[model samples]
Target: MTGTAGSSRSILEGRGERSGRRSGGTRTLLIGLVADPGFATEIAHRLAEELPGALAERSGYRLHCRVTVVSETLSRGEGERIIDLAAQRRAREGWDFVVCLTDLPLSANQGYLVGDLSRRANAAVVSVPALDMLRPAEQARDIVVRLILEWAGELPADSGDQEIEGGGVGVRSGVQPVAPTDEDIDVEYAAPAGRLRLLVGMVRVNRPWRLVWGLRNAVAAGLASAAFGLVSSVVWQLSGAMSALRLGIATVASLAMIVLWLILNHNLWQHADRRDRVEYRQVRLYNAATMLTLVIGCGVAYVVLLAGSLATGWFVVVPQVLSAVIGHPAHVSDYLRLAWLVSSIGTIGGALGSGLESEDSVRTATYGSRERHRPPREPQHT
Candidate 1:
């Protein structure tokens, strides 16, 4: 009876081992190192030595593991092929866990390709900062080994347990709260030109209220220029004796008013309060468009005035009409009407154009939020 009992126990133990191996429930790890030449082989070697023991000590589960060093110089398509090959091998051999360690910036095109490959290969990809070859190699190996052990059920899920607190076997809770750091605060300042920078500073100080101020300031400036230009033109037309000199003064004044109007409108657009930092490129583009619209508005106003005069026949009829009606002299009623018409057209067109351009600038700034703003490339080694 004693012999039969021992035989039954032995049979159960052997079956359990066979089942574990066949089903890949037994701890197994495959590590792939995709990095620059100098650090790749070193990581593979260290992972081979450390991972198996880590699994045993942490979870009491023995492991079968293999590590491979791959080159970073592989083309993107070639990299995908390599990853597919690795996945096929893992599926065929029934690998329980796969890990990829890379020492490349994750935002680069090459890095993105490798990341896609790792995902398809059913691997957790960890990026190691490539400050130095030897240092990152050690770091990569440690991280990859820890990750493999954790995934293969060789490490506890709750890393906070005092007993396994510093065993280097488990992952910490990924749910820890994060606080905003200095890097998160983006304050971009555009140097003051004319009056725009001052307006931008004021808007920053007041926040949302600044948008109201910006709109009011833009409209006020545009109207002020139109008013001054109209008054100057009327004064020149009425003073027939000194018309040439008065017209010269009027022209100079009109030009000054237009320049001031442009300066104020531009500043208002740029200074408008934004919750996020202004993108300099987009702002510049918007500014260019605004300037173009200003010029177009002024040209349109001049053309409209000429067309109004032709339609009214002011030159032929003005003197006779004034002699009969006012008893002395009057230039023409159409002059004031034409001035108002021109100003109204220009103002409306400029406002609509400015608003559309500003909307485009805002859209571009928002869309570019996810993009990494890389400075001009300094020459790279590889």
Candidate 2:
């Protein structure tokens, strides 16, 4: 299989080179427009119409650029899939360069996505703020054309020589430079670092809450398991022959409930990215801490219940750590008490942890200290 894969790759590379040569030296430019779906489509449409004409006039190159608009909301895997498709097409047909344009600021994950794709696909990546899309069509056209020219090695290296005509009469030339907005840039660059800090802070602030929540989940799961076990034991007592069937049904139901709980929890955590940008490692640590706290809470609750049972002289309903070994059955009430106590503690701890994580994320997301606006020094104190 590996040999076949290697041979296929060799064939593809050879074909890709041949395709590049067959295009009559008219390099195929793959322009990837990633942004808000609605905005990206609009910008792409304008580019499709205006670019060829603008480039033909400005650079004197009949540039055949193909613009492919990809919405940035796609998952990282999905984005890679799209890039793979583009590369395959390029290799078969022919492409000179791939340029990616995004309406997101460079400081955002979306901005990072563009950079990632640029490096992976060996394409030029450009980021433009969404607000800039509101500029006049001609103005937008100019920026796009200029960017394309720059990528194609047609634009002058220095900024001084570049001029845009018809500025005042609504043909806004060079209105908004082709650069990411300050806000977008700030978020893109600051978010990951900020998120990490936020996660750490949350761990500190919400440790108690997380401990509580973990206890709660653990107790709930344990009670459910114990109940199923008790019910199975009762079935065995009532009907010796049919006990196995009854026990099987109870086991299946318990398993189903556990599976459902797990699925719901997984979904909630998966979609919580917008809330805290929580990654897998952070979530794993949180779950571990929570479960440990739950166990501790349950142990404490068991001791309390045992003390109460002993003082009340309720010998009929005794809390036993191991029913079979002690020859004393565990009471349902004791299990209920433990479950509720543990769950409450776990919930509290989880909430606290999540909040702290969010705050830490925000703090860390902010880039290097804002430039302090210092008052100019008074002329020499002579």
Candidate 3:
């Protein structure tokens, strides 16, 4: 009877310990999603919906996602150090881990960084430009999840650390794993960032389509140029005489001219820190993004002009008049040729019209939020 009573007391003690654990609940890991304004913000907002659930499923931990959906440009003397910016926020917020999403190009020493991970601080920076533009949010989710899992010791020890020629086994190819270069960083993915991919991403982040409205003056001037060409017999003859190849070249040249005019007129290029390789690459990246934004803006202008010219030509220009100039009956091809030629001519007017736009207008249209926050690039006084 004494033995039976002792066993009953032990069961009560076991029940009490289990109840105590139930009251405590599972430990919650805090994950911060800090993004630069624009696409990065969009990605963060998107991930916030699924990240907690996804991380919990993948890492077997309860997760609380904290999203900062604006520009977190940490000011430093050398300007924004992406890694430091992320690490500081992680420490300040007391988050178990942080993942910074940014469209700004991240340079690592001499090479470009695809991912910058500081295991010690439990923070990482994912350069959105380095990921494939198609479905970047999904790619970012995968990367962020893996990094968190690796840091939490949930992933296998050998799974994510080995460096391969193009990439680590599970990570994206052409983005090789990196050993820590910075004192604060523990793991990194530094590769020759695909220049075209980076440029495209930068253009996407700049949201050049916004320029369509921003350059109202440019559009107005282009429409005026197209209107004049439609009424002119000389323009009709010239457009008809031009071959398809010539029309394509003219389109490219005119677009280039407008892009150049905007860059030179507004002083949009980043001029500082060209002597150091890292600074040179960064400046080059920003300049390239600037050029691309203008090119895309011009490209949109050209399309608008082309469409307007075609519509105007159809309604205003008599078919018989165009046939008389080219010494052949006007066909659909003739109309296209005329529209193409007129659009090229119109884009030049856009170049001139762009001059009327304020520097702030051009600057805002051409740069991402990070660059927008920066003072305009100035000339070296030396």
The 0-to-1 C-alpha lDDT of every candidate, in the order given, reads 0.37, 0.37, 0.71
In the range 255-320, model 2's lDDT, one tens digit per residue, is 344333433442222212445643444454444433333234334533443343233323332344
On TM-score, the candidate that comes out on top is 3
Ranking by TM-score: 3, 2, 1
| Runs in model 3 lying further than 4 Å from the true structure | 1-25, 61-68, 71-76, 87-96, 119-122, 161-172, 192-194, 272-274, 324-327, 364-382
Best of the two (1, 3) by lDDT: 3
Q: Which residue pairs overlap in candidate 1's backbone?
A: none
TM-score, each model?
0.30, 0.32, 0.79
1 or 3, greater by TM-score: 3
Which tens-of-lDDT digit does each residue in 188-237 have in candidate 3? 76556567877887788778887887788988999899889888889998
The clash count of every prediction, one per candidate, is: 0, 29, 0
- Give the runs in model 1 whose Cα sits over 4 Å from its true position: 1-36, 68-74, 77-96, 107-121, 130-138, 160-382
The local lDDT score (0 to 100) that residue 177 gets in candidate 1 is 12
Give the lowest summed-lDDT range of ten residues in model 2.
Answer: 365-374
Tens-digit per-residue lDDT, 1-382, candidate 1? 2443354234323434432343343533445544433234455556667666655565455555555555442223322433344455455544533444433323222111112223224445543322122243444444454444433434344442222223211223111111212231111111112223222322221222223233443344445444443434442235333344554554445434553454454342443235443345334433443443334444444344335433443443445553444345555544544344434433443353334334322221211210112122343378
